[model samples]
Each structure stands twice: as structure tokens, then as C-alpha cells.
Target chain A: MRALLVVGGHELRSRLRDGTAPLIALVAPIMLATLFGLALGGDDDPPLKATIGVVDLDGGEFPASVQREALNTDELKGVLTFRQYPDEAAARGAVDGGEAGAALVFPAGFSEGVGAGRGGQVSVMESPESPLAGVVARSMVDRISALVEARTLAVRASLEAGVPADRVQVFVEENGAAGPALSLVGDPVAGGRVDLAVHYGAGMAVMFAFFVVGTTARSLLTERQNGTLDRMRAAPVPLWTALVGKSAVGFGLALVSMCATWLSSVLIFGASWGDPLGVFPLLLAHVFAATAIVMLVASRAKTDAQADGYTLGVAFVFAFLGGSIVPVYNLPEWLRGVSLITPNGWVSAGLSELAGTGAGPSAVLGPIAVVTGIGVVAGALALLGFRKGRFA
Target chain B: MTPALVCEGLVKRYGDKTVVDRVGFHIDEGEAYGLLGPNGAGKTTTISMLVGLLRPDEGSVRVGGIDVDEDPVAAKRLIGYVPQEIALYPELTARENLRYFGRLYGLPRRELTSRIGEVLDLVGLAGRGDDKVDTYSGGMKRRTNIAVALLHRPRLLILDEPTVGVDPQSRVAILDRVEALVGDGMSLLYTSHYMEEVERVCTRVGIIDRGRVVADGTKRELVAELGGTDRVELTLDGDVTAAADKLRVVEGVSEAVVTGSSSIRLLVAGGRHLLPALLAAVGDAGAVTGVEVVEPDLEAAFLHLTGSTLRD
Candidate 1:
């Protein structure tokens, strides 16, 4: 253990002095964060604000419940502002006049058809001026619609179980007037509205961290070529000591890259990374997974050039496909699922889920577990590769 | 005293190719032992096994009475190794490299601090130890490489072809430092293809050929086994091949072969006494232009044992 730490500290100092690592690991991500953040309305820009038109021809408890429960949640505090229109034509007029990005209109028989478990429909009007506002409105409406549909199915099941129709009606009225059965405050419209600067900042940190680890992992081949590795192996320490020590430096660089980007984003861009308690595990897990992946890449590579090429290749692939090059919310829905397969994807996703002031603490738990799994499996394979490789 | 290093049959193989065959030797405390061999003769492979950098497939090595396989850390603690290539980190200063390696061998921080200066001074690199290794000359880099190895003050120092590509002056300085180490009671295992270096620095030498130690003994003992024969080189003005044929039939000449365009080399029991017969036997072949008889040395012993010169 002493030897491991000594070797680790030595490698850290040596690489830090080289200056390339500090540039790639420490500075590059901050620059990316600033560039991407400024592109997406920097900290000094006005907070995202859009008005959403709402029309209630049904004038019933269900549409009122959705407006009060989902559309007005604190999660959309700075992004969405709701307006009540007297009817569908008024809402459409407001949307066409650019008073609202989009409007949701509930038909007169909508609640009656929903209670009857029959045909029901709602119409939406969107203006071309604010597509993102339309998206936020659609997401919130879709969530509320799904919640109502589930509740309607439960009513149908109870009615089939020989419950009275009047009692089911009473249940719906009481619950609809009360708090939402599924709260929208946790993940609602603003799920995608996570401060873009913070989201892209986290992604940049994640993507560039691979470069830091690449140098450390590629050192195995470099040292082997230059004969330094053989000299270390010639010492009294175990062969694994060299690998562990170098990897410890890699792990430190990963952590430092993340924290530096996070702190710099906060200080420079005024972006809050949600709660640190929620943020830390994702940082550790994502960094661990990134290190493991680069180690595996380096171990399989036969030469230093091959290792370098593969490291850059993997970094870019993860960055672009995992939503680092573009914000996760901007990626296609299918690509979002694909993004979770990458270490960068999980980090971007989890960090974005916990972005902003009201972020739920538990939002990062899922990504943490998944990224940690990635670390474990990749870490195991990397160990096998190192053992099988010429790391001796 | 138990030998400072002992190996009965250290073997290392890669698939069907055995790099280091059942090689065996022992070095007593403070004795400088040289393993002499040409390139690809398994000197580095053998040294790797001895230093615990490589695992022997079918044999064992004990350093300072500790079995390397059983207690590698302890066995390695007694050994310092210098590779043919300069192995110090290029971006690190010589002192930094020494300090790191010293810490690796478990030297305490205070001891390692002072010991780094001492080792640098010992290698004649004291004032320039602060410079990064990449900024140094080839010879300085080689010196720093040796300095890192000596930081821990191991009981045995194993250097594998240390002076292969160094300048003449630096080679002399390195040899001087190594000779001083030996004089200070440090056990040493030096491997090189240069027979003269082995003869000058080592008390005993092992001649290895094709992964096998053909002979190991003191210089005088190895040459004495040659039966006091002298090596004679005769430059003639006639056909060298004809001259070699004539010299082969001489009574005292054991072997005669054409060495160059007009020169014949002969291994003779008493070269000087047989000189007249050799010249007379060369009557029609050529008049002897220059005749030289040399006393036997490590080169002759190597040629005798391996049937090839060290240059081969």
C-alpha cells in the first residue's frame, strides 16, 4: 500500500509537470463548458420564460386537476408560465397572435367520455415562434394525460368488480380535487429544462476526462517501450503496484476534472449542479467507468500510437453519442436510451436530472448504479487484459 | 558464508523457444561475477530472472538466502538492477527518479532524501541531479540510470550490458564507479559481450553461448585450462590459405586457420619454439612478413571454449 501510494504520487507529479495532462484534464472542459454554455444562453442571459395557453371547455374537475397538479408544479418555475383562455378559439387566437407557444383545449364531453372509458380527445395549438416552449407544454400535458388515463383504468377495473358507478365518480372527484396521485414536481416539463450550461458542462467534464485517463493508461505502453516499466517491476514491489499507482492518478484526474468543471461552471456561468450530495456519487461512478474503459482500450492496444488513437476514438464516440456534443434533452428519444450505455451518457443524464435549484436528491441514484455497474464490468475486463498483456 | 546470490537452474521459455535454459551459478558476498556472452545469448533474460523481473519456468533463484518465488519482495530488497537502456523517467529530474525508486524499495523519507544526494554524488552526477533526464547527454542519462539503481544500497547489483552504447570517457567513469562499488564489498553480477570489460571488472567470469554457460572460472584458471598455449598471428606475403595449410602440419600447432587476406592465426602449444619450423614450413607459400605470438587472455579462453570469438 505504501508502495502503491508512493508510485501514485510520483506518477501524479510527473504527469502534472508534463503540462499536457493539466491542459486536457483541467482547462479544456472549462473552455468547452463556457463555449457551449454561452451558445445556449449564458448565465447573464434572461432566464427561459414562456407562456402556455390553457382552454377548458369541459369545465370539469379532471382538466382543473391537471392544471393545478402538473402544469403549475415548481419544477417549471422559471421556464413555463400558464395562461387561462376562455375557449378553444380564444386559445388558438392567443397562440396565432404569439401570446403563447402552445395551448391545450379540453372538449366538452372529454371528462364524460373518460368516465365512461370511451372516446375522448384533446387538441393542441402550437406557434412557430417558440418550439422549445411548445415542447415543455407538450411534455407536461403528456405526463398529466398518462396519469389521468391510469386513474381512469383503475375506475374501470373497480366498476367491473361490481362497485357502484356513483362511488367511482365520487373517488375521482375527491382525488382529482386533492393533491396529485403522482406528483409532477419531481420530473415534469423542466426535466429537459435543466440549466443547459450545467448539463453541457457536466458532459464536457465527462468527455475530456477520458483524455486524462488515456495518458495514464497509455503510460503502460510508453514505460514498456522506454524501459521504465521494467525498472519498476525490477523493484521489491509487486507488479500490480505499477498499474494500481498509475490508475490511482487517473482516478484523481477524473475527479479533479469533474469538480473543477463543476466549480468553474458555478463561479463563471452561475450554474448550480443541483445538490452535491446527489452529484458526488455520479461523479465517482462516471469517473470510475471512464477510467476502466480507457484502461481496457490501452491494454488491448499493441503500441503507444494504437492506444492513443483508440483512446481519442472512444472519447469522441462516447461524447457525441452520449449527448455531450449536444445536450441530452436535444437528442432524439431513441438516442436517449442509447446514451445510457455510455459512461458520459449516464453522467449527463443523471447530472441533468439533478440540475437547477429544486432538483430531487434521488434523481441521480439510478444513473449512479448503472455507471457503477459499467465500472465494475469494464474494470474486471481491464484487469484481465492487463494481466494478459505485456504490463509485466 | 552463503553465496549472496544462487540459482540452480533458472529457466524461462516463451512457447517452444527457451530463452534462458537451465543456467546455474553462484556469487559470494562482495564478489564481482561476470556473465559474458554475445547478443541474443540470453544474458538479459538470465539477468531478468535473477532480479525477479521475470519468473523462471522450471527453476528457482535465491537472493541473500531468500527464495525469490516465496518471498519476492524480500529477495528483491537485496538486489539492484540496471538495464541496457536508460530507464529513468525523461520528464523527471534525476533526484526525483532516485527518490521515487528509493521510496519504492521502502526507504524512509528522511533516509531517502539524504541517500539521493549520496548516490548522485557517487555516480559523479551531484551538481546536475536537478536537471530533467531528457535534457542530459547520453552518458549523463546512463549515469543517472545507474544512480537510481544504487539508491537502495542493495547487497547485489546486477547490470545488464550497461556500457553498450556509451562514449569512451563515460564508459571509463561508469566502470570506475562499479569497480569502486565492488571494492566496497558490494556483490555484483555484470553481463556483457565485451570480454575485456569482464576481465577487468570481474574476479570470475562465466562464458555463455546459445543459452548455456560453457565455462565459469577465474581469469587465470580459465586460461590455464588452455594448456598454456599461445595464439600466433602470422602475416605473410604469399597465399594465406597455403600458409595456413603449411602451419597446420607443424608438430606444436593445434589449429591453424586463415584469418585475413594475408594473415594466418594459429593456436600452438609453444608458439615461439615452433616459429622456425612454421617459417620453414611456409617456404613456397610465402615469406613471413610479420609474426606475433600473444599470451592467452579471456578472449582466447572464449574462443577456445565456444569455438567462436566474442565478436562473433
Candidate 2:
């Protein structure tokens, strides 16, 4: 144990002093996340945000309800910034003048007509310049229409079930003032909008982490080429102690890289990876998988140069296929299935899940098992390679 | 007395090929032994097995009476190994590298601190011990590696071609430092293809070839295996063939051949002394302009035994 610590401490200090390790491990991933984040969105806000105009003239409970829910919803804060107009003409003017991406106007008698089980009048004004915002507003209006119809049907059913007409009207006016369809309308993800940036931060992190922590394993071949490995082997300590010492450095650097990237994403780009308890297991598992894979790849190389080539090749291929540089969903359907085989894919999937709504510790249970399994299998294969006489 | 290191019938084989076959040697305490061989002659493999870096297919190695297989850590404690290349970490300073290895060697903390300084001074790198190894010259790197090997003060110092890629000045310094260590009662097992280095530093030399030790003895003893024959060359002004025929009849001349139009070569006993008599015999055939006689050395013995040069 003393020998292992001594060697590990030395390896850590040496790799830190080398300059490239720290740069690749700590800085590269954060920089990639920032650049990709900026390209996706104009800033750290959602990738697609636009201003929408709302004009209400209905003087009824249903139109008031739709106006309140659509204008000030926090879940849609990233995708929709709401503005108010005095009239439908003014709302059209805002859309035509490009002051707003889209607009909504509620006709008078909208609530009474709908409460009588008759249809209400509503209109969506859209602009060619901001089609996404227009689609988002239209989708919210459709959900509101559905909510009013469902409430009208319930009121009629209540009357038929012998509830007094006066009481039914009070119930309809009170509960119907605030619609429950806002969650589906406010959240772009639940409305079929994909946010690839959620995965980009941790995705780039794990990919670059492979290169950073992998160098320590590749140093085994470098040491062998330069004869330092033989010197250690000829010493009075167990040779495997040297390997353990190097691995401890890899694992430590990987941990630091992961935390720094996660923190950078949160602090810089406003990314929220939900519940630390849910994400911690995936972080540790990803680190182990990265280290074990590099060690296994390096052990199969005949020389240090060969080890470097193999490490880089594997890092890049996994990055592309696993949605680090490009989203896995952007690939062909068949390729998305292939992504399931990569460690980065599993890590990004877990991070994306945690970044979404209502995520708990159970969000990453599957990813944790898969990533940890990869580490165990790869670590065993590396040990077998060492046993086959690549120890020095 | 117990030798510092001993091994017999050491063999190492890869799948279908034996790289070292039944190679055996011993180095006594305070004595210097050289294992001389060309490249791929099994010296490194044999040394690896002896140092516990490799396991022998069919032999046992004991260092200071401790079997290496049974207790490798104990056996390795008695060996300071200097491989052919400088093995110190380039990113680390000389003192840092030494301290790391010294700690692994199980030296006490305070003792390791002091020993690192001593070894650096011994290798003449004390002034630059705090600089990163990559910033130093190649020779300085080699010296620092030597310092690392000597830090633990092992019973046997095994150096495998310590001067192969060294500058001329550092090569001389390394050889001098090694000789000084041996003079201070250190047992040494040095491997190299350089004949002069072995002839100068080692009392006994083992010549290995094609995975076998063809001969092992003192330099003179190996040279005497040639049966005291010497090579003689004579330069004649005229009639080289006739001169060769006349010299062939001389009392000590074993054989003579006309090598050139004006030169005749001879194999003879006591070549240095037989020069004058050969000149008298060649006098009738031609006027001898120059004469040369060659004596026996390790190179000649190697050529005689293995039929290949040291550089081969």
C-alpha cells in the first residue's frame, strides 16, 4: 500500500506538470460546451425563443383563463416571451411589423358560447419570420380550446346528473378560470421540442474525459518504450502496484473533469442537471468506464505511438456515434440504436433525463448499471492483457 | 563464500521459440563479471529473468541466498539495475525521481531524503538535481538514471550497456564511476557488446551467441583457447609468390600465402620473434619493406568461437 501510494503520488504530480493532461481534462470540455451552447441559442437561453402578442376581448371566464395561463407560464419561459396588445388590429400590426413572432385574439362571447355547449371564436396571427413561435402559440391555443370543450361537456353532464344549474355555472366559472392544459403547452419538450444542449455539456465532457484520463493508461506503453517501466519492474516492489498507482491518478483526474464540466455548464450556460443524488452515480460510473476502456485499449497496443493512435480513434468514434459532437437522434434511426452500445451514449442519456422535469434518483438507475458494467468488463479484459505479458 | 548472485540452466521461451536456452552464470561478492554478446543474443532476456522482471521457463535464481521466485521483493532489494536507456521520468527532477524510487525501495523517510542527495552527488548531478530531467542533456539524463540505481545501495549493481547512446565524455565518466563503485566492494554484473569496456572493467567475461554462452573465463584464458597462434603479414618489394614459398619453409611458419603483388601473409607460432627469420628467408626472394604481427584479444577469440564479429 505504501509503495502504491508513493508511485501514484509521483504519477499524479508528473502528469499534472506535463501541461497537456490538465488542459485536455479540465479546459477542453468546458470550452466545447460553451461554444456549442452559444451556437444552439443566441445566448444561454433556450435554442429557440421568440416574442408572442396576446389580445383579449372576450370579457368572459374562458378567454381570461387562456390569456392568464399562456402569457405568464414559467415552463414556456425559454421558448415564449409574451407581450400584450390592446386589440386584434394592433396584434396583427405587431406580427406584421415583426415586433412579435405571432399573436392570438379572443372574440367576444367566447366563454358564454362555450359554456352553452356551442363553439367559441378564436384566431391565431402568425409571421413567416418566426414560424416556430407561431407554431408554439397555435399549439397552446389548441390545448386551450380542448380544455374549454372538455369543461363544457362536464358542465352539461353535471346538469343531466341532476346538479342544480346555478351550482354548475359557479363550478364551471371557478374551475374553468384556470385551465389544467398549461403544462403540456408550456413545456416545449413535452410538446415534442428536442433540446440537444441538455446532453451536449456532459456529452462533450465524457468524450474529452476519455482522452484526458486515457493518457495515464497510455503512459504504461510510453514508460515501457523509454525503459522506465523496466526500472520499476526491476525494483523491490510489485509491478502491479505501479499500475494501480497510475489508475488512481486516472480516476482522480476523471472525477475532477466531470465535476468541473458539470459546474461550468450549470454556472455558465444555465443548464440544470436535476438532483445531485440522481446524477452522482452516473458521474462515478462514467469515470470508471472511461478509465477502464483506455487502459484496455492501451494494453493492446505494441508501442506508445500505437497506444496514442488507438486512444484518439476510439475517443472520436465514440464521440460521434454517442452524441457528443452530434446528437444521436440526429443520426439515422439505425445509428441511434448503435448509440446504446457506447459509454457516452449511456452517460448523455442519463444526464438528459436528469435535466428534464420531475427527475428523481431513479432517473439514472439504468445508465448507472450499464456504465458500471462496461467498466467491470473492460477492467477485466485489461487485467487479462496484463497477464498475457504486457506488464512491463 | 556465498556469491552475490547465482543461476543455473536459466531458459526462457516464447510460444515456439527459445530466446534463452539453458544460460547460467554466477557473480561473486566484490567481483565484476561482464556478459558480452551482440544484439538479440539473449543478454537482456537472461538479465530480465535474473532481476525478476521475467519468469524463467526452467531455472532458479538466487540473490544473496534468497530465491528470487520464492521471495522476489527480498531478492530485488539486493539489485541496483541500470538498463540500456535512461529510465527516469522526464517531467520530474532528479531529486524527485530518486525520492519516488527510494520510497518504493522501502527506505526510511529521512534516510531517503539524504540518500537521494548522496546518489545525485555521486553521479555528479548534484548541481542540477532540482531541474526537470527533460531539460537536461542526454548524458545528464543517463547519469541521473545511474544515481537512481545506486540510491538503495544494493549488493549487486547490474548495468546493461550503460553507455550505448552516451556522449564520449559522459561515457568516460560512467565507466569511471562504475569502476569506483566496484573498488568500494560492490559486486557487478555488466552486459555490453563493447569489448574494450569489458576488458577494462571486468575480471571475467562471458561471450554469448545465438542464445548460448560459447565461452566464459578471464580474457587471457579465452584468448589462450586459440592455441597461441599469431598472424603475420610481410611487405615485399618484388616476387611476392616466390617470397611466400620461401617463407613457408621457415622453422616457425605454419602456413604462408601471397596476399598481394607485394605482400605475403603467414600463420605462425611466436610471430613477433619469427619476424627476423622470415625476413632472412624472404631476403633471397625479395627486399622486405615492412612487417606486422598480430596477437590474440577477446575479439579474435569471439571470431574463433562464434565465427561472427562483435558488431554482428
DockQ per candidate, 2 decimals? 0.58, 0.55
Cα lDDT tens digits, model 2, B172-266, are 89899999999999999998778889988999989899888889998989989877767676887988878877888898776676657787767
User: Which structure among the candidates has the greatest TM-score?
Assistant: 1
Q: Which candidate gets the maximum lDDT versus the true structure?
A: 1
TM-score for each predicted model, relative to the true structure = 0.76, 0.73
Off-target runs (Cα >4 Å) in candidate 1 are A42-191, A218-220, A302-305, A332-334, A356-359, A389-392, B90-93, B127-135, B220-296, B304-309
Candidate 2: tens digits of C-alpha lDDT, residues A181-200: 45454454431133445566
Query: Model 1 residue A362 lDDT?
Result: 86
Candidate 1 achieves a global lDDT of 0.82
> Which ten contiguous residues of candidate 1 chain B have the minimum total lDDT?
B303-312
Query: Lowest-scoring 10 consecutive residues by lDDT in candidate 2 chain B?
Result: B303-312
